[model samples]
Target: MHVPDGFLDAPTSVATGVVAAAGVGIALRRARAELDDRTAPMAGLVAAFVFAGQMINFPVGAGTSGHLLGGALAAVLVGPWTGALCISVVLLVQSLFMADGGLTALGTNITLMGLVGVVVGYAVFRLVLVVLPRKLGSVPVAAALGALVSVPAAATVFTLLFAIGGTADVSVGKVLAAMVGWHVVIGIGEAVVTGLVVSAVIASRPDLVHGARGLARRTALRTGEVAA
Candidate 1:
């Protein structure tokens, strides 16, 4: 959900801004480890895909809308560090150029979608992978499960943020109910889309899919590596 300007007070906005900045800063340094000849281009593709996907918004509570947050998809296809960077750039562009989310709330947007979404999604993806069979096929399924949870997790985070800094004195309980409720539905759709995209990638180049690294054959990856 892209939060609008003035939704939160100055202190809360500043606080989230600091958190966002720190998160992006860390990602920038760590993402270098994740990026390479094959994966660098994948980062670009993921950013574009997420940008397009976010355009389709379904209403959630408190004037915020939920859409296909490609957190799980990106984290699965690319490493989490790079995925965070991909989404942070998308948020920056969306706020500055598209006016999709308020400029003042860019920090909150990044904090929500970039940091919280990617981190939570990636963590859950790894956890799910551990439980499932360690096959390339399981990568997509784990990603789907991650996508299902990440949306609501982000929503829950937003609710907490709103409760801490919401301009209107809305009831946290009601807000939580609405945000989580709608997000769960959105999450289901996200899971399906994430599964499909990841499945396609796995079918084509499982090697390029970061979450499939150990599972995807290294020899096959060498044979499958395409010119950058």
Candidate 2:
């Protein structure tokens, strides 16, 4: 979710900014391991796809709207660190150029969308893959499930943040319920988006997809490391 300006207090905002900066720096360093001639283009395409997908916001509740987080999709197609950077790049571009998210809340947005979303989603995905039959089809299915679960996870994180530093004195219970409820629906969209994107990348150039590349040649299943 793109947190608006004035949503969090100054101290919290600054703190989140520092966290976001550190995450970005770490991602920049780690993403080099994931990026290559083929993956570089794929990364660019994933970023653009995420950007365009975010532009189409869906009604969450009453009048509020939400968009595709795209972290799980990018992480599955690219790599987790690269996916975080890609999503952060999209958020930064949108915040600075389009003013979609508040400038002051950029750090908060990145923390929630880029770091939490990617990490949580990818973890869920890998776990699911470990449990399921490691077939080519399973990758997309796991991606879908991961994406579906991650939206509510992100919403839960946001609710916790709001409880800590929210300017408004809203009921924590209500906020959590509402946020999670709406995000469950939003997660369906995430599932579809993640599944489609992962499927596409796996179909065309499985080698380029960091998640899919771990699969063995015979079963298209991961041989080692659990497709992390």
Candidate 3:
């Protein structure tokens, strides 16, 4: 979720800003290894797609609407490091141009959605892939599950941050419960969107999907051996 200004104090925002900056710096360096001619173009497309996806928010409950976080989707389509950078770019543009997320709380949004979301989501996807069959079909399933888990995880992290530096006098437990509760429903939407997109990409251009590369390489090798 794009956190607005005044939700958190200046100190908390500054701390998150520092963390976001460092995370972006690391991502920029690591993304070079992940990006190539073929996938580099896909990165731009993925960013645009995510930005657009975030614009349409569906009502979850209690006047709280949720949108596609796009962390798992990006990480599954591109590499995790690049995915972090992609989401950061989207958030930056949204904050500056659209004024969707607060400028002062931009770092908090980046840390929550960009850093935590991508890192945790990608990790979950990889873990699921390890347990599941290493086939093209498994990629979408893993991506869906990853997307499902990531939303609540991010929400939990945000709740914790709010407890530490929330400007309003709110019950931490109630906030956590409400945040996680609504986000679970939102995760379903996230899962559906991520699964559809990942499945479509795997169907057409499996090479562009970072999470499916190992399976692709293995399939290629098997095909070559059979030909031989």
TM-scores of the candidates in the order shown: 0.93, 0.91, 0.94
The C-alpha local distance difference test score for the whole of candidate 2 amounts to: 0.88
Best by lDDT: 3
Ranking by lDDT: 3, 1, 2
Query: What local distance difference test score does each model get?
Result: 0.89, 0.88, 0.92
Off by over 4 Å in 3: 218-228
**Candidate 3: tens digits of C-alpha lDDT, residues 33-106:** 99987689999999999999999898877777889999999999999999999999999999999988999999
Worst 10 residues of 3 by lDDT: 218-227
**On residues 99-162, what C-alpha lDDT tens digit does candidate 1 reach at each position?**
8888889999899989888999999999999999868889899999999999999999999999
Of 1 and 2, the candidate ranking higher by TM-score: 1
Candidate 2 lDDT, tens digit per residue, 1-228? 899999888988998899999999999999999997767988999899999999888776688777789999989888999999999999999999998889999999999999999998999999999998967778899999989998999899889888889999889999999999999999998898789878887786566677765573643434223444
